[model samples]
Target: MSFITDIQQRFKKGTIVEKLIYVNLGVFILTFLFNTFGFLINYNGNFITDWFILPATFEGFITKPWTIVTYGFIHTQFLHILFNLIALYFVGNLFIQYFTQRQLLSFYFLGTLFGGLIFLLSYNYFPAFTDELDRSYLLGASAGISAIFVGIATYAPNYQFKLPLIGYVKLWHLAAIWVLLDFIQIPGNNSGGHLAHIGGALFGFLYVNQASNKKINFFDRILELFKVKRKPLRTVHKSKSRKTKPTSKSTKADYQKKVDVILEKISKSGYDTLSSEEKAFLFKQGKK
Candidate 1:
């Protein structure tokens, strides 16, 4: 019970990306357990999982619309979930460095939606998939993770990562490889999945470009609608002479000046040159 409570507390306090990972892992575990039980009972378990997977046909999609988002959380294969989760952990961490948690959720969900739409359209209209349309169903977090991976790369193309064998590589280089693989695999088996990946990656590229310029987030309204508003605490003071300190307008000007100085230093010398105190101050300002 204590362990469960501790987990619950951690989840509640975790970042959006962390919470998303937990949800996906939880769903995967439940699906695995149900399938195992069904196997022991000699029953077909796909019927249970199928409802959450996005179907190719428009008619089937209309009947299970929620699958557009839910499909990204359903994974039956161990290796599939393992790779997706690992990509998500790294990409999500990188994404949050330049953007807010809300934007991350927006990119993830909107990317998943776009992926599903592309999958359905490709299956229905493409001559290559006409025969497989009726039986196709999509599942797994690949699309969502692809969005995060490509989104961050698009936002920071020059960012570097050091790998064991590859040494140092630019972010865009890795992103290009991923996108190229998806494009090349479209003609092979699992074409629908690859197409969906391309769709998600495309959205990631477009979304980051637009967001970087306009500071717009499509998911903000939806998130706000569901957000729980906390009531402000009321404090009663018995003293009649309680005085608050008056903040000078120069304080704001001084803070902005300091921020500008730090930003200029970052542009000239890179972020690593900033002192710890300067970094903390910049971070605090960013939260505002």
Candidate 2:
């Protein structure tokens, strides 16, 4: 009980990205355990899990419209969820550095929604999927993760990551490679999933560009309408004498000089070279 309470406390205090990971992991574990139990009893588990996967056919989709979003949270394959969670962790961390938590959530759900629409359209209309449409279903967080990865890469094309063996690679290069792969794989097996990835990537790229220019987020406003309002907390304060240190122009200049030095260091050595204190200072400056 104490262990569970500690974990719950940590989750509550964690960042939105961490919370998202926790939710995905929790769902995957529960699904896996349930499926294992079914397998032990010689029963087919897909009967239970298939309800959460978005069907390719229009008739099937109308029956479980919620799967369009729920499917993004369910992954039966271990490697599928593992890779997605890893990408989400890094990309989501970087995304939150420049965007709000609400924006991140919006991008994720919106990406999933767009991906499902693309999947349905392609499966129904495209000649390639005519035979397989009735039996096909889509599941996994790849679409949402692709959106975040592409969105951040588009927002900061020159941002560098020191990848193992690859040395240094620009953000755009990584995003381009992923997009290109999806584009080339459209006619191959799992074409629906790849097409959905491309759709999500396109949405992420366009949305971030618009958002960076201060365009309205209609999806965010829609989410706001459903949020419950909380009563404002009342507080009493006691007045106390406190000495405030005034910052002079010289001190401000000195701080700016330090920041410039840190920026130069980052440019030369990459972000990983910075100490925790330096990283925290950079993060604070970014928030401003």
Clashes of each: 0, 0
At residue 48, give the lDDT of candidate 1.
Answer: 46
For residues 1-288, write the lDDT of model 2, one tens digit per residue. 999899899899998889989999988988878888888999776544768889999999999989988888988889989999999999998776555676677778878888888999999998989999888989988898888889877766767887999898888898999999999988888898898898789878877666545564554554565462211111111234333433798876876787777766654555678799987666555423
Task: Tell me each candidate's TM-score.
Answer: 0.80, 0.77
Candidate 1: stretches off by over 4 Å: 40-42, 212-274
Cα deviation of 94, candidate 2, in Å: 1.4
> Which tens-of-lDDT digit does each residue in 230-284 have in candidate 1?
1111111123243443278898789778877876565344456779998877766
